[model samples]
Target: MSLKILDQLSQDFTQLLENSYDYNVVIEVGKQPNIKLYKAHSAILYQRSLYFRQKLTNATKKNNVIEFKIPNLSVQTFDIIIRYIYSGIVSLENFEAATIFDLLIDLNEFQFIELVERIQAYLLIIMLLGFHPSMIFNSDDFKTLQENAFIALLKQDDLQMEESEIWDKVILWGKARTPDLPSNLEVWTDENFKSLKATLQHCLPHIRYFQIPSEDVLKKIKPYHNILEKNIWDDILAKYLAPNVPIASLILPPRKKATVQLPSRKASIITPSSSIITLEHIAELSSWIDRRSKIYNTTEIPYEFKLLLRGSRDGFTVLKIDSTNEILGGYNLLIWKVPNGKYSERATTADSFIFSLKNRNQSILSRVKDESTAIVYGKISQGPIFGNGLGMGRRSKSISKEWYSSETVYEKPIRNIDAWFFIDEYEVFQICKI
Candidate 1:
């Protein structure tokens, strides 16, 4: 009994292989159940035999013809379809689902508009299965595919009538396509106007004449004179104007040049008073010292003068003199010591007087009675002196000349050797015998 059953199963499986169609034909069967039995048999037996023979011939040929082979079949669907050929059983889950978008792309390429429409209907079912409805339209190559489909549809006598009307029909057929189109006729009218304007600009020169006042004719005549009065308007007209001669040439306005004036040197100078030092005098003094210091390789004149002439924030002393020769409280007395054992107590008073004179002449020097050595003192003035010498004579020459000449010739009077005296409000005097 067991041997009989095994033999029967083996025969059944062999029959399945002999009757089974290729995977692509099995998929077609699931799509069209009402397909004629004779047609199905012819596709499996005669068509497959011819395909196999052509493939075998191409394999041997040096310049081989490319064959269109179907994509790989699903394993489950392949098994079910093979079983169905033998047992005539129909199974839903084991059948491969047809993708309408793939079919539409293929049908469009092959000039099969009827099949394309049928595939479009199948796409609605795919959408119900949670697939994106726009997947068919959103491909980067969709434009080329659509052009091929449109050309194929135009070739057929039945579909050629709907060639100009396909865009509207497709939009109405799909909810996804409808929303993307212009909502109303007015929007299309505006788009048409813009397109017409661009076309007129492009074709204006090519058009020789026109009986009607079309935009192309109007633009060719250059009727934008009123709008192009401004310079900016000319730029706008130049961008869109036809290459043909303009009706009227636009007049351009001239550009304005900006005027600028340099600052005056007179404004930089500070005006001076008769009683006070003039800026010109101060500038002359500064320039004179600068040139002299550079030539002499010495910065002493400016550095020393700046101490007294330039006021400090520490409240320095100054001597004020009225016309009566009476001195005011602003006298600044800087005292210095005579060398020890070199002079009497009274000599200190004479030395202080000499120190005052040093304020007037920076190189002033004095020697103690025939001594070879000398002590030098320096002086600076904030302002010009007014009067003459008090303790020393007016003819007393500066000690700087004696030192420069390398001689001890003294031609000035040596007066009182005891006290300090003011020669003027800004100068002091002293006496020595050497």
Candidate 2:
């Protein structure tokens, strides 16, 4: 019977490369004291990598050794390349975007066709969410970018950089890529401008100059005016001055999607700087419940609102002002978890509030005053107000503090009600210290 050798062969091969056992060739990679020595088989190198084959062929005139002094390649990135060569796997976890991009460059240089495709795809995913231009534009890595890769990046609508920042980076990269100009702009001649323009020729069309703000344009772009065509610059300024007048320029829309997500803040009454928002930025909404749809007419508030509660662990409870202009929810503040799970009654001994949000910017906050009072945690209950109401500012001792119960609706109030106090369509918000 033949031996059943699963991934043992792969493991053995990986070990062989790692230990440098019986290797016929040595690759002296990188530069100076930071250099790395990788021992590999010439036969395996030729079979597995077209890049290695060509490189080794050129170096192997008479000696068994082949040395590559790549000053740009880091020892860590080279180790990853060597590991991939032996194991046929690229481990990207725990690595940063700049590292992936550097390895991607090596993969391209060696014509690692399949690996190139795989790494490029991975790089695009990082570009969408992880890659930050600031990490690379100042480095030599930006200068060595392949033309297609550079162009593709310029065309990206979701690059996660402000248009002004992108413009600054493009100028930097262009200057680095172009051949010698005077170090100082004052010493530069017409020839220098022409050379820089030629270098950025393909990239210029994609810059989306119209999207840059006027202040940034005046400050950042004016210095580079010599490199741009007169007509192009004129049109960009015109668009900013008179936006109503449309021009036949290649004006692109700003990237609105995939914005940076702010970190979660706890529901509290103070700001991150510990400033009291209620006393400064916002005021408590009046308890007067006068606003409503006309009789026989049901008008919705036309907004979505949620309550943020600090005592309930920054609980997010959503409510809707219905077409009948009724506040349908004051769902007790609770953290989101699996439904129908057993929960306890949360009692807050301190001040708390709920916010109704029209847009994320505009909010109306409703405050709660405790008279030795407690808001009971319902079995997924909204609020007692939406359940029936705090009947027209009517005070009753015998009502469920929070939950909706079929057994006990509130007893007859002193009056029917002009409207429900807690159930009135009022914008609500809770100050969060997040």
Candidate 3:
């Protein structure tokens, strides 16, 4: 029989963290007017984090104390991390979800694997609890997100924000990425517009351009029309003038709005066979298929989904896992046929498309730009292929074993980053009218 005294041990460590005079590490965090200096024992930090251990190993020591600066980190965020390093405890109940998410990303950077997992689980719970706020995109740190992450965020269809506000944020983010531009748009030259357009090349296609109101378009977007493709800008102008006239530019469906729904007294159950998707995803796919301007509710979906193939049950699979939660797939309007004694074959169709269903709420759709190569057929060993947008062949293998680049055969990239991902399980469903 064994007895554990973790509570007392934890308390002792907490007390030591609060009042230890023998501390030999000084960390300067944040910048000028908002800066702070934190004192801690190097032993605790060194043992708690691999990142700290590496830093301390290379850190110069003077007067028996190791000192370093983390100018980018906020004092409040570091405070929480430092305390957890000693006491192995953190209370997030008092903090907003955005604050907690920021902490989670910082913790991951410090290689605090266990704590990062815990924080991720907590954040997932919060999402399930339906506690979402637009504060993250509007935060001061919005410009600090990586291009890929920012693109993924923008692809979210259910963001609780106005299209105009999103356009403003996009412009802000684009300006941040392209430096040395004047604050005033009137002073901007053609070079300034070109630079910003290049920076936001992948981002521009995701915005629901047609969804923005005419007033907001004129007020918020008109000043930056030069940054957009000429055809897209022309289409925008044409749309407002003649709402019924069709244009060449793709008009993405309007984003979904969040609403509180009261559950019925009687229970209803509907389940789809696929493990990777849900009924709501089915509704989304149906809307895309029919070219609807708005998403349909699950109960309103008109297609009866029939399971055709299962990856796990069958032999269909991909290679290693990607760290991100991006799901890549394609829909081919034409039927797949094996090449007759040839190494490969190509099928053509304008309707075929590739997509990245990123992180559940976000999606990026890339339609076939070159109809001549909409689908590529290869041997069973090579795997199923969908043009250069999503394929397995020399091009896929030539890139780094861990990544794949878009060949631009599609109108845009499905996944923003040139990366390869694993498929734990995949299923094909045949959609039939009810």
What TM-score do all the candidates reach, one by one? 0.14, 0.36, 0.38
lDDT of 1 by residue, 1-434 (tens): 35446557656654645554432222222223232221123223223244333444444322222223233322333344334333433323211223222233333333334544544443333322112223444445333333223223322222221211333323233222223335453455544434433423322222112221235334433332221134433433443464353534432222222221123323343332122232433333333333333222122112111112111211111232224332211111233222233222221112111111211223222222322122222211011111111211112221110101122222121222322333233322111111
Tens digit per residue, CA lDDT, model 3, 251-361 = 888877754332331213345666677777777777777777687677677666655445444323122234554556677777765565436888888888777664335
| Residue 71 accuracy (lDDT) in model 2 | 62
| TM-score preference between candidates 2 and 3, better one | 3
lDDT head-to-head 2 vs 3, winner: 3
TM-score of 3: 0.38
Which regions of candidate 2 deviate over 4 angstroms? 1-131, 138-140, 265-434
lDDT by candidate, in order shown: 0.28, 0.53, 0.70
Residue 302 CA displacement from its true place in model 2, Å: 30
Off by over 4 Å in 1: 1-53, 56-120, 126-434
Cα lDDT of model 2 by residue, 274-355, tens digit = 1112222222222212222221111211211222222122111233333433222232343322223334343442233333
* Order of quality (TM-score): 3, 2, 1
What TM-score should be assigned to candidate 1?
0.14
